[model samples]
Target: MTTSTTTPLQRWKTFFADRSSVVSGIITLVVVVLTLISYTGFLQAVERRSGVVFVDSIHRILGPIDVTWPTFVVLYASLILALGVLLTRPEHLFRTLRAYSILVGIRVICMALLPLDPPMTTIPLHDPFVALFTSSEHSTLTKDLFFSGHTATLALLALSMPTRSLRIVFILSTTALATFTVLQHVHYTVDVIVAPMAALLAFVLNRGFAAENQ
Candidate 1:
């Protein structure tokens, strides 16, 4: 037998070139770039506008107590971990990206059509990601809060994972994230509640594209 130096990832990649991961990957890249652009633009546009206030029931019930200890850090960490899992498999990552394009496109529309200020009691989430594109450190990017991106993103990954076990685990993470987002009052009750449906729709539409690509 020949000396085995090739890694397992190389074997997997070699087996699937015929399945058109190359095309899927290219589309995913394009979509990822576009999504980032649109997301940044949306945030900038929203930042320019005055926030419209809504009386959020969850914020009223929870009273924006500023629980930054475990709830805040743990929820943000879960989003990072969910993304890491999605990147573990090429096929899974590509399909999830395709779905994400749909999810993000819908989100952009929702944010544009439903532009509203954060709840008066909304806890500020000075996210590091938002800071990347912000014009100034003094400016707070808090107005782009129509639906919950964190909840929707984790929901998309949960719905689009390749394996049953991975999907189950991802869903659990999504549930945890949804709970924390609600409890933290970072998102309105309706915002987080409606996000998973949007994500599921995105995944359903992208499945057809994924099937055709493979």
Candidate 2:
């Protein structure tokens, strides 16, 4: 009987192992982890400053937004997981992730530098949706203006898509979400407007970086 020899499949493994890809992946992961830690710390500091300790305040602001909470959670989780998977293949993931990392870092920095008081300070909630800003015992890390996480998160998801159609869909869907947040008085008008711009800034930064490297 003749022995059959199995050819080695080395090319597939080598596909994403280029120098740029590896460097970019490492940078992205470092940024993601560090930024998250910093973000949590920032929020904690905000809480400390505000002096409010009741968890109900958190729920009050969030309850109205919960109208689409499940959807947001699923979408956000998928985006993050997708990034992780892409990282496994650095060649495909590096540039994109790097760009996103920049966005995240930028947002955090902006928030830290300009912490805003949330609307809860002034609005009173007669109902779940109608709750205006209530006074918080503790201050938050960031102010209510300069950006909107919901909008930015939605926009980030949209911008992550390479195709135009998906981006447009994300923009539209997030717009609706933003509208709901405003109608419910969860966010100020400025916050909703700023979110999209922040996302756009990310897109431009990513493109510029990619071009510079190429």
Candidate 3:
């Protein structure tokens, strides 16, 4: 009798061949896409409405500095790195997607409940890539506050990383992004401060749901 062993390629093939995995991935993608669409529309409406603007001591200290390009560089670079690592494990990618979708959904709800106006010293963060996809009228949004999406995104990535070293790297990246967002006055101190906690909550909830299903 001859024994056969599965190669890495075969394992990947098996993972893709699984009907459940494929269906789960498709559903996750659809949910994420729909959530993002709703988020964008909600933000546009929020921008049109007037809201309260409170004085933040941290923003007063840091003032407003335009670090838009550097902010996007760090944000997108960390995102690309996280995707590269997560793509190696399809299950991890799915979990991350589910967690992120939940995070964005939470943000949408929070922003709706807490209508915040942009900081007095606000410097608009102009993202070139966002500009490419969005019209000029809606590209530069300033009122999507109460929680910083940039900070939370990096924090979630840090939490989702499988290895300690990567986690540390992403944690530091999260801190840097938080600082950049504050320095640019794109978000308030409270927004950045609350972001990591929100991400942690989302990650924990997603893991708990996964455990229950298992």
lDDT of 3 by residue, 58-104 (tens): 98888688888889889999999998888776777889999999899
* Best-fitting candidate, scored by TM-score: 3
Clashing pairs in 1: 52-117
Model 2 gets an lDDT of: 0.56
Say which candidate scores most in lDDT: 3
Q: State every prediction's TM-score relative to the real structure.
A: 0.83, 0.64, 0.91
Cα lDDT listed for each candidate: 0.73, 0.56, 0.86
Candidate 1 matches the true fold with a TM-score of 0.83
If candidate 1 were superposed on the true structure by all CA atoms, what would the RMSD be?
4.1
**Model 3 alpha-carbon drift over 4 Å, by segment:** 1-11, 132-134
lDDT score for candidate 3 against the true structure: 0.86
**Higher-TM-score candidate among 2 and 3?**
3
- Tell me the TM-score of model 2: 0.64
Which structure is stronger by TM-score: 1 or 2?
1
lDDT of 1 by residue, 33-136 (tens): 97888777777887777756777766677756565455546556666765676555555667777788888888889988887877766677666655776667
Candidate 2: count the clashes. 18
